[model samples]
Target: MDRSPLWDTFKALPDTFLAYIYAEKTRLAMAEESRHVVNENQQIVAGFHHGYEASDDQYHPGTFQPFMMKGYWIPCSEGKLFQLRQGHCSITRTVEGQDQILYLVHPKSATLFAPLISKYQHTQVDVPALALSSFRTLLIALPAGGTTEFAMVKVSLNEEIGGVRRLLYQKECAASVANSSVLKNKQTEKFTCLEENLSFVPDAHLIDPKEEAVQLSGAGMIHRPVPELFTTQGHYIIPLYALFGINNWPLLNALIEQSQTTPTQFITGALLRPIAEEMVDHIYRQRFYLEFHGQNVLLKLTMDHNDLPAIDFIYRDMGGVNCRLGDVQLHQLPEHLRGHAQYWEPNFIPDAAVIMEGIAKKVLFNLTKVFFKSEPTTRDPEFCCWRAKMTVYGYQENWTLPGADGRTDNHRTRHTPKTFYRYGYFEKIFARELLEVMTRHGIFLNIKRSCPDYDYSFFMDKIGNIDSCNTPCVEFEWFSELVKMTLPHYFQHQDAYSRRKNISVVRP
Candidate 1:
């Protein structure tokens, strides 16, 4: 890895400053002296003779790949070459004799990746090109170990709404977290771990000296201080559609078999129960609710004490966080973080039950039950019974809200006047349905049920001309049947929306 060229360019700039960032790299290289290479039937063969994990045979590279130099460039749609803006340019070459990709970003964009480029060049001994795509002529390369899996490159087709501006917002949000009190100090091991897991995308700058930028379309240089953090890797994290797809059978089968043991279960039980409990606790205690969607929720694997594969979870993309407006005790937080807590406003505070709705729809129904329905091995009554049992267990163990007096709360939160009045009949019915299913599974036989006694006829009687409006509760009703089935029925309703909605997710 060479930094002389980039460093020289940086030094030549008129004004520049260092932005503190964190990077880490770990690797194990085999001894060159012990390496063996052979030509079998004209195919090059090489193998590791000594290592923790040894292989008998591996493909050997027969060609050399060169790094991109100062002059190489990717041409725009109009055939004009993209030039380096400021000192923000990176060169990455493949290891096994592949094409080199050059990333040239505006000075503003560079801040998001500079620390990463420096880390890769220093640690990996080569700035390897990752799976990155750019809509704006200039190529972009994400920092290694960062969540680049969700990176997407698409043509902006919306005529009325602006895509670039939205991306800028995401950038600003990520930068906000990066510059927050918790991250700026970077003195603790937890912060180090967080840095390794998260990737940031800062607001992009339009660098069209000739007035020809792909995303900007000739908009002059603009600077925004927005940034976004992406945690889950798109490839490793199972997509929400994978529930409907057939290719997920293998993983589903494995998880079903593993579910017999509490430590190894992937879908529900021990793995998901505690996390859901944490989410509920966060909402009541910290007023922060996470968007637990399939795209946001990743299925990760980690080894347990016995060295068996067990499920783990990672959360990122703080832009989806739902905040509640109220007084919060911030004296315990760092001096800088205390100020930030006061500045942020609650943007999307839904009925409290919506949080549980999202968790159950995504984790319980979409991720878990869909697999059993799809896979032949797990589609039996036994699997359904298992799923039913786990559903009750999960809610009882995690979703219980304690009253101020401290008992089980006995579903008091669901029946509160404030909740029902604020959210209307839709939320009330949804909450009742959830409670009924849990009760049917024998979750709260001992505690007096607080679910309002409302039957299907009650809903039918109340269903007046209110169906004609374009509001959230009515919109939710269109797929109430699917909700009754405990699935993400809202997705079906979303499909029929008259106006387009942006449900953006990260990708690599």
Candidate 2:
């Protein structure tokens, strides 16, 4: 397989290479276990059938000629390969002589559910091909082991559904992108379906009809790079989790130094903030929610105009994304996906908030823990104190209902800003910072409210409601209060830092 110089460079990085090795070892073990279980199950079933004199010939008699899904020919001459084994659902191999990677799906793995609702009562699932004319993104999905043919089907269906999502998201956010700086600064790439006119199918005879088959043929997606930053050479792409590896400390320090920024600043500003902004903006404007966990998101490191390291994020594996079609026009959807009930939600704010909370708790907080583990000197005692204060006093413990009835309801029962503070100090600070940034972009004011008369009391009254039935009025008011609550902590941290520097602090 022809290898890109980038791949060679990737392997040369001691930390990244070690991380890859560690992850690959685990993946190989899992794959082996999966294969073993499959084979064992097949044997047990076969033995049982033989006892009953059941013929294997009853099922898929003779040679099994599988139905082929049409896809564009992505020529990978000499079958040269550099494979990425980090993914769970599919394995990505670099396409030779092209700026693309092919995702070979795994059969008998996790099902890829199509969010589009149909007449069928059960959820629909299939693979779709994804054709990206631009940047590449990496992500890990659930692992499954199966036949190459099944992998092909999964890949095709995933790509097809993903392609539709990309198209709709781009179109829906087009006008907003032109006007919103948050959307403009945040980057994503276009995806389209491979043309049906093209004819390309892998050989079916490579697998024995009787044995468990695991080959890398049949259906797959040839995706190009997604982020424009990726198109530039010399940028290193690393998954977020990889940074947590023990062997990657030196690389992390080098990145911080190259960025000409402190570890805290680099992480909060470059990594956490950008991801938060993009996610919030997408949900607010496009009603599109992504799975922004560590494995699905990657960091692209390169240099900025100041020759300092610039960090950007890349996302992939859109199969699990959520899109609320309550306000969306049916005409905006592809003809085939129009009536899918799975994509429709009466109210999406509650779910969006949950996604935001996940980002704070799962992604940002975990990242901070790893960074602090690696760079203990960068820890801020003053910041920690401020975080603690916010955790304890930043949220309302109870909502006092109207009428001198002395009735007070615990706020924990609701999905309010207070819900975020319960996680820990990191979540408290992250929520504060994220809300601060979001409010600056007028998110609170512009968000679709559940009630026009929404205020603090109205919000409190509707607490603990179902997601589809809950009001976002509380969210709007709570977000505003949360931002206000951050001012004191921000100033306190700033004052302490300034004092330590023996400099006079000026309040903004």
Please write out the lDDT profile of model 1 over residues 1-508, one tens digit for every residue. Answer: 1333423322321221111000000001111111222343433242112212222111101111112211122212212121112122223334345323333333233333343344334232322111111111111223445432112211111122221331323222332342332322322211111121121221123232232232333221111111132232221223232332234445555555645542113333434544544543444334455565444443344445654555445443333444443332445333433443434343333433454655444334333323323434434554445434434433221222333222211222222111211122223333344444434543233222222332333333333322221121221332233224222222233233313333332322
What are the per-residue Cα lDDT tens digits for candidate 2 across 23-111? Answer: 32221110000000113233321100001111222111111112212222223331322121222223333445442223233221113
* Error at 341, model 1, angstroms: 4.2
Clashes of each: 15, 24
Q: Against the true structure, candidate 1 has what lDDT?
A: 0.30
**For model 2, how many clashes?**
24
lDDT of each: 0.30, 0.36
**Candidate 2: regions farther than 4 A off:** 1-232, 245-247, 326-329, 340-347, 378-425, 446-508
